[model samples]
Target: MDRVRRAARRAMFAEKPAWQRWSLRVLMTLAWPVGAVTETLYYLSVLPPDEIPRRALAWADRGGDMLALAFSRNVPPREYYTYRLHQPDRRAWITACLYAPESYPLLSWLNRRNGADNNTVQDKSRFADLCRRHELPCIATLAVFRDGSQLWPATPFIPALPLLWVKDLSGSRGAGAARWRLDAGHYHNGDKQMTFSPEALARQWLPRDCLVQPCLDNHPALAALSDGTLVDFRVVTGIHRDGWVEVVATLGHLPCGGPSGRRYIVGAIDRNNHCLISPTLSGFQIIKNHPDTGAEITAQPVPFWPAALELVVNAHKKVPEFSRFVFLGWDVAITPEGPLLIETNSGWGAFNHQRGIGAPLGWTCFPDIVAEYLDFSEHGDAACD
Candidate 1:
């Protein structure tokens, strides 16, 4: 519901007159202080009393330097951006404050800025629009794409593309991605075809603001007609003080569950080390075939590991603002001879499957790569490379 609501807001906002929407935005920005005050009162009830100031200071530091207005000072008034969340470590900094410091959300750019297609693409509305504008095969993503058992409706903007990619906005263990083939009759499964009219597919199953991707048709391109499972690449990168990027690890995946026209995905993480975790099975274990249908499982290790490397190097220049931040992870998709961004992430999880799949063992031998490209290092190319 949340994801859908947000997308609806984006559609409405996008259609509104520029000055009218901007004016409303300005009004909302001004009213944020009221919400912050209520938040502070809630914290006051929880804290001991003495640690409030100390806790607020810690968040003030982390909510991004050059503090937001209403809190920019030597003492730093409790700004809404950095002082509201009262994060895990933030609450600890204060001796008695009940609140974990909140993040100051003074800057709207972080929430609105655009990024590559393959990185953790969360702005379902923004990115979908970009793909439509550029005529690229992409997916429309929503931040809260789905919640538990409910899926948001499809807010597709383009009919020109035949492929639509839907991703659950909440997570990535390959948990949220789904592929949809919009053709005349209905969705095509591995061996079976379940037919549904276009009307029902939109009103009934599809999630709100999904990245409706045009299927990577391998027919004309590959010379042989094979409807193989599409694959995506992940390249985690970070910026060094010197501003050069390094590549951490590129993990490739082939779907296991097979696109059911709507829900469910079964895929394996191909960690470059000769290890391929079967998407048919969960975790590090590999399954040879689909559990229900017994279809044989197969995969193709990325033959052009070096070309995948070049794409990562080029990303830093492509997104100048994304250069900051301590971490960024992306699932890069292959197109023709190069790569197209599938999604980007600020909080890419540290999963064992990922390391086993092909991550650097301990950053000792691969220090330079992880720092700039993988976005894992506190130190960028400055120290390692």
Candidate 2:
């Protein structure tokens, strides 16, 4: 019965014209509020009954203005705050309410402009070219291109490099990233062996245009935390009111160094932005030691923290097209030479930051942050909202 139902759905979907299918997707995206309500109910179901009223009061106190604003815009308050209730901290829910799409006009506008296909900063190949042209310190990335049915490597290779990371130019969260290693008489991608023939590889990896680069050797400070897995600092930066770029939040994600890759044991960065310590699973559980090696990560100093911040700031300034984004998430690797740019995220996720600190972002405290991004002054006194 399940197979028949699945086949029927697939046949129906395939019968639709491409334009019709795309239109349906767009409509579904626009109707996120409906799905948001369903999600909120699921979280509410898991909460303790005795503490519900107390948490509700806190939510009202912290997210009242934002919630009211959302309601006025025909967006339900629960639609915005639902998923956040799963967090141990009640503040996460309030923060989500404060930044809900209906109330935060700037978020909606930015989403329309730079979300999905519109965002170029997420393009790994394009970003590598930018870095090369600007002479910024970054890994040498070869952009793979497709010619007819054949895919070609961007640069000549000796077939003996120790390691390479093949990444989808438009992928994120390490989903499209794959590691290749030169082994005895054969090439290996993770555990699978690949044919040495270029044509074989091209046929194997369809829909070309990938960015290939040498695997980054972790700096000693980061390596100490998570053996060989690449540990990086996620730096959140935004344009400040005074017309200067500044770091808003910084955190570290240490991998457990196994098949469960990039699933980090999150840590809180110090006020100085130079050290990471007191690892936690998004404020849900305290992680005292590395899951793989049992090494302590608490109160560890990250080497060359100041330089990493400066490099990120310079990189952000070079991209004028991304200025409208206002907020960017940067994955930075601290190498022995200096800091290297791993990638930049326009639609950066908030799970790690919110979970790591277990606190609300500045949405409620500073309503002007959203106002400034929206250019509210030109829109005529958005102060009333």
**Cα misplacement distance, residue 347 of candidate 1 (Å):** 2.2
User: Candidate 1's residue-wise lDDT over 260-299, tens digit each?
Assistant: 4322222334445322343423343445654444544443
Instruction: Name the candidate that leads on TM-score.
Output: 2
The CA lDDT of each predicted structure is 0.41, 0.58
**Which runs of model 1 end up more than 4 angstroms from their true locations?**
1-121, 127-163, 168-177, 182-195, 203-207, 218-227, 257-281, 286-304, 357-361, 364-385
Off by over 4 Å in 2: 1-41, 44-105, 111-119, 146-158, 192-207, 240-243, 260-262, 363-367, 375-385
For candidate 1, the C-alpha RMSD (Å) to the true structure equals: 15.0
- Writing each residue's lDDT as its tens digit, candidate 2 over 1-385 gives 1121122122222335778855764775577556555544554455445435466666444354334433343334443343344335553454343233322333334434333233457677677777778877888754354433323353443345667677776777786777776656555776564545443443444566566677887887677677476788888776544446677667788876565453567765776646666577434456787777777777567887888888877776665554545667888888888789887886555545655544545432223444453333442433221
Q: Pick the candidate with the highest lDDT.
A: 2
**Could you give me the TM-score of model 1 versus the true structure?**
0.45
